[model samples]
Target: MGKIIFYEDRNFQGRSYECSSECSDLTSFFHRCNSIRVESGNWILYENPNYRGHQYYLSKGEYPDFQQWMGFNDSIRSCRISPQHQGSFRIKVYEREDFRGQMMEFTEDCPNVYERFRYHDIHSCHVLDGYWMFYEEPNYRGHQYYLRPEEYKRYTDWGAMNPKIGSFRRLHYFQ
Candidate 1:
């Protein structure tokens, strides 16, 4: 059995969320236990979202691993994943993402500065899928540029894009 927690405010309004579970879908996992109130403490935190519950106290700069991240994502049933810049999150760690739907592959520009702006003739290049798109600098959009790997060349360049972008598409809220 999974646990559900409700955070209540002085206004009598409350927010609800839950942890991961063996169950497949969203509804079964986020139990609506409105009457159950959990204060600002980790005495109820857990390891496995569903099975083992271990409460933990995380301060401002803490970061959870991929599983915990996914568990939080699932419990909230949200599409947003907050990106952390420093500490544990900024560092790359091997993670299992078998439950995710589609994966995005991104390649950064080389020569550092080339990542920002190219000199003479070369432009900043980033290959997200089959095709490579030229930008004035790296972090071109500051937002992720999604593209379909198969149809990459069709958009800008085709020849090298095929091999470059295997098959990935930009993911938007609508898509």
Candidate 2:
């Protein structure tokens, strides 16, 4: 898992988020995430669930008080140039006018590669080694979705879990 930098504007707040290499494109990151700075465990990640793209882990700040930590996340997440990437490390926030859609490029003058995200408004995305990890925005919230090899396994019935239902489960299990 890693973190991405995100901000709506310069005056806007900026916050770090957790990320997971496990999740990519569709989903990633678990519920109980560990933070290096903030204590973690504030509330559910992502205020809403109208998400698309892959999911990964995202994290930010830690505090003794849950409410306080949440407040801090809320405060910093408002900044523009919200850093959005796919990895297991916190990224730097982008500059204003960066949030064109659901992407954040790496080049300052001209980024060779731009990291795509599910949504810059709140959720973040990261790409690692040809994979993607989706994560909720702001440090305080918890997780909404995740995409990873394991989940793929479950969906495809390759590595055990094979968690599915009905005839589709049998069809996937066979495949």
Q: How far is 42's C-alpha from truth in model 1 (Å)?
A: 24
What is the per-residue lDDT of model 2 for residues 1-175, given as tens digits with 9 covering 90 to 100?
Answer: 2333223222223333443222222122222222223232211233223332222222444333223323323222111111233333322222222222334422121111122322233222222222222223332132223332222212221111222111100000000
Candidate 2: lDDT of 31?
Answer: 24
Would you list the C-alpha lDDT of every candidate in the order shown? 0.25, 0.25
lDDT of candidate 1 vs native? 0.25
Instruction: Supply the TM-score for candidate 1.
Output: 0.19
The candidate 1 region of ten consecutive residues with least summed lDDT is 87-96
| Model 2: lDDT to the true structure | 0.25
Clashes of each: 18, 60
For residue 59, model 2's alpha carbon misses the true position, in angstroms, by 3.2
